[model samples]
Target: MEKIGTIASIKKEATIYKLTNPFRWFAKFGATGGLILFFISIVALVWANSPYQNVYEDFKNINLTFSIGSFVISKGLILWINDALMAIFFFVVGLEIKREFLVGELSDIRKASFPIVAAIGGMLVPALIYYLFNQEGDLRNGWGIPMATDIAFALGFLALLGSRVPTSLKIFLTALAIVDDIGAVIVIGLFYTETIHLIPIVCAGCIFVSMIFGNRLGIRTPWFYLIFGIFLWIAFLKSGIHATVSGVLAAFTIPSKSLVDGHLFVKEGKSLLNEFEVSFSKTKTIKHSQNSLTTKQESIVATMETACEYILPPLYRLEHSILPWVTFVIMPIFALANAGITIEGDLFRSLSHSVSYGVIGGLFLGKPIGVFLFSFIAVKLGISKLPEQTNWTQIIGIGFFAGVGFTMSIFVASLAFLDSNSLLTNSKIGILIGSLLSLTVGMIVLRFQKQK
Candidate 1:
């Protein structure tokens, strides 16, 4: 009977492993989010062009409301996704930005110079190109569109190249994208904002000040940040500073230092674990089943869990918990909500508009040129050095990859041409063309590079 049960358990474990193996492989590949984003985008494109286009429109326009004692927040489904969910996405981005500046690639001025300079060139050149093409009218507001980089898409493409690409290059791209996000947040705050409301701005300031004090006072609770963060978001939403900026601001206040040091955590953990083992042996006679943990064992387990929490910074904990949701759920929903646009009637003529021209030129031509040229100048001027083991050709190839600004470009397009559906459609079409070209050409360039 024991042998039969053991054999059954082995078969069950094998079945579970077989079921989970594919997901594990995908996660290991490290571009799972990008693949999902691409799939959602394709679905959106198809649905927009299919007979279900009306249904898609109806779904987007569906009204959603939240109210608390006559304080109401109401918006269309699309706006709710963009304004609410994307706030969460930006919050993650903010946490990443904070972490990078504090301890990651951007921590040291000397080591950070390369990616920082490269990112500056990346932003300035594309904005310049976009401005040149759209200088005449409201089209100029879209210069910020190509100034952004979709990090997930860019990094995902790099992940596909696998061992051929150097780790330094990936790190450089990651840092560059982060800097690009900072620029995007600033642009949205400065250029994209409408009329400013002083009352809400003051409210947001006071809330942020309280958060700063909380951080200094060693308050490490996630709930404290979450409650304050929602209020901050609401304040910014009413303050005319694009509520997403509040996400970043709130993230900056998260405690990056742990309550307990690693050494202390390990010592405490070992003691509790020892107690757990002793309790387990004592209870073994009373309860043969694994599920039948004694009170002492449960207390030990709870203590170990608390120790685990103490050793991890709130910033790291929040990011680790929230990133998967942002990547898998929020991003896919955002793509579905925003990427749907009908492609009909004189596609060439639509693509010929100055907005389209600016977007395509900025992303396809300007991004690589700006990134490579500025990098060259920085290296020549001795302001920065190339990433280790990365040559100039690889830099050029990465410049092309940086040109794949799908997500952020579409976001800027939505903001820039919100009043004009035709202009927004043109910009989206241009982004698709430009991003596709950049992705294809970048892959070709990197794939054919000679290994050193």
Candidate 2:
């Protein structure tokens, strides 16, 4: 009894340590991605300004082709990254969005109200601010550019504040960002695009139906979705709606529920373990010889694999495996491919442009006001109460943090402008300036609050 108690105490201490440092693991994820982005940005800046500038330009301009019989898909490297690979990114984003809505922060109406209302205000106010300044012709279409929060950068910044920021505050920000991402997706699908073709649209619809059926049928393997999702992506790309929209659609069709619940999983798992032990005991192993283990070992291994299959949720598995790849490889490559903006004489002229001003102002000014005001109103009306241990000052600081719109803002900027060069430069300038200002102000304010 004494030994068992000591063992249990040791296990409890280990569990506590793991729980306390949960953010450390996630922080490393965000940090690695940020580092990759930083290095890529540096390389791009150098390459764009170097004697090899034309090489860089020509590389991006290089036409890539994909053809199936009479249907040929051709685009520049930049477009491929923005339209194709970024679709996978959006698909992952969609998965996160769905999970949050179904079971995470946005699951309960009262719990969701603060972030949902804040996200709405955050999106609407920035868009309105952008539209007010850029109401000229095609520039009016760029209003969505400022309405996004870059979760990676924002979370990374929050993590840097250590325990000064409450855990509840971080949760609030994360939830708000997730809601903000949903709004961005809707805005992109609805407002940002042009004509849509019916044939491809029908094809996409059919694929979606098939995916739904797969979910209903308890199909667990990822291969079916991957193959069909590629086809759906192509169909959507051809349909003239952005290919990235297909990612969101595909993610929506993925089954969030496990085939077996946790209670059943544990019961079945223990049964499988007992069976495996029985099988192993039947085959007496002499010096751990492979021949001694025989067919029983193989059977036990298979049973263990089956048990794992039943126990692990597909959504959890997918998120765990793909998250590292998406953050480090895909996103960094995207930044490298897109972040290069050749600074020229007309750079100042581009800065003076309505699109540039709209993006900068919307992110810098609109995000905080929108987030705070909406949150305050929601709490006041009793739709949602503030997170426990979080004050208004912390909320305002988080609002500022929300304005650090790097990833999604750049993505929207790419879609918003027709002329790539002007868009790229303006977006880089705006993201740099707005993100810097938001970070500086948020940090200073939070520090002041802590001191007080």
- TM-score (all chains, Cα) for each model: 0.96, 0.88
Backbone atom clashes (below 3 Å) for every candidate: 0, 0
Best by lDDT: 1
Mind sharing the TM-score for model 2? 0.88
Off by over 4 Å in 2: 1-30, 274-285, 289-294, 346-349, 447-452
Candidate 1 global CA lDDT score: 0.90
In the order shown, what is each candidate's alpha-carbon RMSD? Answer: 1.7, 6.1
**Cα error of candidate 1 at position 69, Å:** 2.4
